[model samples]
Target: MDKIKISNLEVFCNHGVFKEENVLGQKFLVSAILYLDTREAGLTDNLEKSIHYGEICKYIENFMKKHTFKLIETAAEKISMNLLLNWDNLEQIDLEIKKPWAPIGIPIENVAVEISRKWHTAYIACGSNIGDKKKHLDDSIYALNQRETCRITKVSDFILTQPYGDVVQDDFLNGCLELKTILNPKELLTCLHEIENAEHRERIVKWGPRTLDLDIIFYDDLILADDDLIIPHIEMHKRDFVLKPLAQIIPYKRNPVNHKMVIEMLYDLQK
Candidate 1:
């Protein structure tokens, strides 16, 4: 990844905890480092291939002047998200907001907040065994794509698979999808849960039956285990239904926990 830096672009805005501070604007210095691939832009001498710093500066100025927030942290977070969303080629951003004038009634050089935000690649497994199985799966995908913080990159064809667990239920329609999102692991899980709830997914039966079942298969090669969720799906490497659809799209994607690719897992399961 390459970097484009913008430093100390000053803006006069009303952002403070004090009432008078909001009435009388204060000076703020904003800086940013944008991460993206600039090699093609350099080789082709095309501005379109790269992010424009001049335009970004203007955007920052306008954003600061237009929005009023009590905390600089909120401003930084909003700015970072907006920049990444607006610029299709931008992969990550480091943003900082500095306030030179403080209402704390103390001698201070400056007060600032800095944050780094980036897009993460995640793989999800979709399954449904109850009524309207295919529609449940499709609707789940649609719901995720409708979110501004998430984008569906690729989807595997849904395949019929025997249900897992000893619940003795109907066959399930299963598939996998690749997602690009700004949400973290927990936040992503919450979003998925919301979609499942919308489809009337029941927790009464464990693998017995469901309208929709959405699981996080992999999240940026992350290995996580908590009370609520586990990464690499815990048993993904041992499940044919999971590996089969996953292999169709990203056979080479390695499991962080087992250090095995999706294709390798599928082969091992078959044997």
Candidate 2:
């Protein structure tokens, strides 16, 4: 990744907790560091292949002026999201908002907030065992694709597999997807849950039957474990249904927790 940085660009915006602060407006210092791959532009000397700082600055000015929010935190968030969404080449952003004029009775020189946001690559496992299983799986993929902030980069063909665990049920149609998302892990989980609910998925038993089941197999090689979610899917390498499709899409994607590639995991599970 390479960087293009901007410093202390001024904007006059009405954003504050005090009434007069909003009415009179105040000066704000906005700065950003855009992270991206500049190799294409560097090789060809093509401006088209690169991000235009002028346009991004103009967008920041216009966005700050057009929106009124009480907290600079909200302002920073919106600005970061807007830039990430509009600029396809921008892989990440580090933004800072500085307010030189403070309404606080104390003599503070400035109030500021800084934030970083980036796109994450995640692999998702999709499975269905109840009613029109294939349709449920396909519908889930369509739902994910519809989100503006999420993009489906690759998909494995749906494969039929026996149900895991002792609970007897119909066979499942399972698949995997390579996804690029601006949504953070928790946000992405929420979105997946919404799609599962739409398919009338039920969670009566652990590893049990369901109309649709969507799990985050991997998220940017992140190893995370909490009450609601687990990365590398908590024994995913032991499950053929998961590894079969995962290897199809990303055979070389490593599991940060186990230090094994999808291909290696697939073969190891088979034996």
Task: Tell me each candidate's TM-score.
Answer: 0.98, 0.98
What's the distance in Å from true for residue 91, model 1?
A: 0.5
Q: State how far residue 213 of model 1 sits from its true place (Å).
A: 0.7
Q: Positional deviation of 182 in candidate 2, in angstroms?
A: 1.1
Root mean square deviation (Cα) for candidate 1: 1.0
Cα RMSD to the true fold for all candidates: 1.0, 0.9
Q: Kindly list the per-residue Cα lDDT of model 2 for residues 1-271, writing each as its tens digit.
A: 9999999999999999888988999999999999999999999999889999999999999999998999999999999998998999999999999999988778988989999999899999999998898899989999999998899999999999999999999999999999999998899999999999999988899989999999999999788889988887997988999999998988998899889999999898878
Model 2, global lDDT: 0.93
* Alpha-carbon lDDT, every model: 0.94, 0.93
> Which 10-residue span in candidate 1 carries the lowest summed lDDT?
232-241
Q: How would you encode candidate 1's per-residue C-alpha lDDT over 1-271 as one tens digit per residue? A: 9999999999999998888878999999999999999999999999999999999999999999998999999999999999989999999999999999977889999999999999999999999999999999999999999999999999999999999999989999999999999999999999999999999998997777999999999999899999999997998877899999999999999988879889998999999
- In Å, residue 121's CA in model 2 sits off its true spot by 0.4
